[model samples]
Target: MIDGLKRPACALPVLLVGLAAVGTAWADGIPWADRLHAFGKASKLVCFLPLFVHFQNSSRTRLVFAAYLLSNLLLLLLSFVVFCSPDISILIGAKSPGVPLKNYLDQTQGFAFIAVICVALAIEAIRHQQRGQAIAFAAIAVAFFANLAFVNIARTAFIYLPVMLALVTIRSVRGWPSLAVLVAVCVLVVGAWGVSPNLQFKMARLLGEVDAYETNTMVIGGLETGGAERLEFWRKSVGAIRSAPIVGHGTGSTKELFANEAAGQTGIRAKIVDNPHNQTLAVAIQWGAIGCIVLYAMWGAHLLLFTEGLSRRKGSLLAWIGLLAVAQNIVSSLLNSHLFDFYQGWLYVIAVAIVGGQLQRRRDTDQS
Candidate 1:
């Protein structure tokens, strides 16, 4: 029994290192990018097996895992049914409504699967009486997957799996040398980010475009800003919020409000801006200050809990990974629309639970 436990424990770090190395290679632009991408996609099935085995050993962890899995399965079935249904156009009163429910169905399927896996892993760590480990798992999973889902599913999964492996490596070894290597890799990654022209250009363009629109709001200039249509919608949204400061006009009111606000303005008309590009601003407009405050409080509570867990296990590699994951998710939330999506929200909740569970475990251990 001792030998069996020791072997898997010893093997874990080596496997993680191998995973990290593969990830770093991809980041640096490995040869045969297409083949690498395909291989990575194929590997997910294999990767999930070990994860399943790890969680299945514990009853509580397994139950949580089953719940998450069942939810995803249900979501998948719902999506599949929606996709197969014929597109129907229904007339409600005077307006003709063309609803593409299929689009929504197709989009959320991957997110559901990803969320289930991450939540399960986090819960597993909690059951094992590894509070820091659980938090670290959830944080890393949320941060990494959030970004990946923001960009591309396959690419994100490819990069994330390796980083996770590296983290697991640091957990098993509990050595300074292993940690030093991880630190060195991180520095290299940051340095690469500084030098990559494509990354720099995209970041600058996104920030600059948003800034220019905000600046133009002060001017008494002509109504047309050519390609800055999104800005115009944003301006209209601000006016709507100002008009109803205490409570929002209503949920899904932005489009209507934008139309009414821009009614008299030349060249600026209400377009289908389903969501504001910025989530915080969107929530503020839809739900008013009260809604924003409630959302912020929830966010703050989760962060506080995760931070407290970190303090208890300052040396945990998993904790560091979790910190990075949380940071990634916060940043991604600013640019993406996943916070309100059911699967995504549940994933975030699980992440918080995972970290919280880890903290509870540590407290119990300390008391004993």
Candidate 2:
């Protein structure tokens, strides 16, 4: 019974991590959320020290560790190139001062730090031969919630790594029941305060206005202007794509095209929108359908890696978390441009490493 009780403790950290991701608006005034985020950041930094010590003692899967490092380095390099190159603007023919290379590098370095911590925890789990299935599932759950449209999708991937670890440590069904109760209580509390009601009303009103504007043949006076503006922009974007069905006008050219097209439309004079509200359309405009296909393939590869773990039931926890994270990213991608976020990129690498480590462990066990 004590052991069963202990299982829920593992779930606590994960639950906290998920809440931290989903409830950031609430955290504006809440001391616990602020402290949790601060603590999570600090813990990620210190996590590597004990992990390195454990690895030295256990002498397990050093090659996998090396591969993880290499993947992180590649991500860091990609972030650097994207943010640093002044010439990149020239290549893409886009306008706007490029992001400072140093800042970009520093941002990704933080992710690298978090990745180290996650890898360390994954190694610890392997050493103890703990249940990996639960951890993976918990990670997925956190990722799914974190990737909600309003949340910072880029941060969802890395922020939930610790949650996955916590899930693996849980040993009881009681933990699930407790989590359900907590979620219910949070929903009721938020609902009573008008948060849920206000959010729902606002989202519904916005969508309704957009739909009404689309369907109306006659112009309605004093109709909210923003919805009409977005529709106009979306239409212009579709026209641009039709004109250049093969290669796009060029990378970064969509904004200028959008602005030009919108300028011609009556009652809409907004400056060129920087991004299409839709991520798929934005990518299609920049990279063309081929680029979009390649992007999808890359995401599919990550999903494949996580699914492979599930098939073997070797690292079920890591696999579930990874699948959730990847799924959230894929879904969120419909609305947000997460491909460029430093945090999510590193999280992807760490997740893959966790899966790889599990596969390696299984292979080793089979050999023995």
Candidate 3:
């Protein structure tokens, strides 16, 4: 409230998050730092809530959105150069091959959002008969998709991309047009799969990793693949949640719980991870069912804010942007706890607050 977040829908989540933090501080075991860690990450929404008022200025909001696109474009250019020329990549001090900057996960996620933005903007350009702008935006969208297919890939992007495309298509078109566009998107995905060995390997490896984790036979040189590690985390998380389902083991308890489980184990099972890699289970382990309710309620409230009473009309682009961001976070959260991570958590909070503020402005204008 002090931060100027007026809507109860918005404020409730912040309030619950604060309460969760307090509860964590009170929870026994684990150091104070560990106790506050998860909630501290969540408190960013509250910390940034004050900026919501500023985004009500449509011009400023547009500027922020433009900066996001330009920055991502720059990252894409550098990534392509690094991916194509290893010598240049090394000269530039790029740490990982093909990924010139952040890990594959963050890059793919950001690029997926860029693809959504380009497609939405391209549709708007076409509607206005701006053929040049439409083509440029569409080409950029395809370029980002190409990076995911041929260059470094994150399996999470494959999840975010289709959900985002379907949402954009359904919101932008109706009836047969929607179906046709969706069909085209599917065909493009299929074509990418057929062409990109990287894509095929990732897909096939996903199944193999899961099978290996289940069979307990995939360890090599005392290391596990990301997929296998995630499976192991999820399984252990479920057991921990069952140990204290209602109120959870309290804040900052996940590591200790995991440590106990991992005790006397070897290989991947011996790995004690603070994060379970799934957002819902992450909360459920810390705060149990009550925490989970608040988490889902917060997500549902934001989704309603962006989706309900919004349509493909003039000035609806802000709503579409907000909806796509929410969708991307939700879909990706299934595999990784984006809200717990610094970069992605802030990205989600900032996108939602800015767009939410602008949408509220539009609603106030219509009412007046």
Candidate 4:
């Protein structure tokens, strides 16, 4: 039933389009609609808070975990359908990709959450020697890579997923040649790239990105894209940060600071940046030097707890899944606003907190 509801290409595509229009405010200004939208998205993370809390009854915790898993599973299926059915995606407000498979993710940034899920799940499946499960999870992940309208998604598919498979799959296959698994993973990833136009398009954009940014070149063919925009944003953001090195502009004020910097200015710096697009810079911008220290300390704590969490069980599966899930947030934050993002931030915290909570359980278990 949930999966059916998730489908953008439902029997009632008209209703789906109507809902999309409402979400977009019909491109018309509506009082407090934006706030309502924000609240709804926020609730996705907020609703899972109790899952982070200690549950004396094991059943409740299991149920909550299952619910979260099912929701993402349905979403994966929905994304697959949207990818194959271009018309449905178009109705749901995907402005780019021409075919517009951007149905539920809103932004390509949401793919990070999906990646964490896929990687963690695949690790678990591999640990258990579940070939069918591993294959299904991998295929779904590949489908996501092909259809999601982001260059980074393709990069993620090629780099992180295969490397993860190479390392993590080694744990399960003791008798077979380890290199075989790595070779197969590489072949499959490259084959996915061969079939996926999305990956090809992103690669083409990257080639001219430098020239586009340097010369204000819009169109040489592929969407007038460039890596220079991020580099430039970083350069200007760093320069502005030097003025207030100790304490930042304050939380949630990143865009405001950028606007202030860009006021009456021209060129790329003239445009407001949503966040520093770098988590380290984002924290520094929000809380300055103190924030960075806090972030590092928090990571240490999370790592320790995740380790302890894995110590709860005998198998190495927990360690592999926990680390893979947590690492996505940290790595993505380096270049994009993953950790600090409202949607992504909640996800990062919740995943770590769950691991932390499990670790705590093990401590209690060991003590008692």
lDDT of each: 0.45, 0.45, 0.81, 0.53
lDDT of 1 by residue, 263-368 (tens): 5554335344545544566656655675466555545644554555556653242344344344434544554434544444444434434434444445556878
lDDT of 3 by residue, 170-220 (tens): 878999989998999789789889999889988887777877776665464
Per-candidate TM-scores read: 0.44, 0.45, 0.93, 0.70
Clashing pairs in 4: 209-226
Q: Where in model 1 is the C-alpha error above 4 Å?
A: 1-230, 262-269, 314-325, 361-368
Q: Name the best candidate (by TM-score).
A: 3
Residues 1-368 of candidate 4 have per-residue lDDT tens digits of 23322322121222322322343332223335442443242234332334334431132544655676566557556665565667876678655433234323233444544554565577577778998988877776655554553332433333444444554555546556677766786686577668766677666667667766776454466343436567667876797578767765444445655677778866554667555667678666545686576556555655554555554464245455556556666666666655545656666656554554454445556679
RMSD of 3: 2.1
Best by lDDT: 3
Q: What overall lDDT, based on C-alpha atoms, would model 2 receive against the true structure?
A: 0.45
State which candidate, 2 or 3, has the greater lDDT: 3
Report the number of backbone clashes for model 4.
1
Which runs of model 2 end up more than 4 angstroms from their true locations?
1-198, 201-205, 208-233, 264-271, 341-368
Q: lDDT tens digits, residues 202-321, model 2?
A: 355556656555663223444444445556656777887787665455444555676666565444544466556555666565445654664566566556756766666556644665
Better of 3 and 4 by lDDT: 3
Q: Flag the better candidate by TM-score, 1 or 3.
A: 3
- Relative to the unseen true structure, what is the C-alpha lDDT of residue 5 in candidate 3, on a scale of 0 to 100? 53
Q: Candidate 3, which segments miss by more than 4 Å at Cα?
A: 1-6, 92-95, 217-223, 309-312
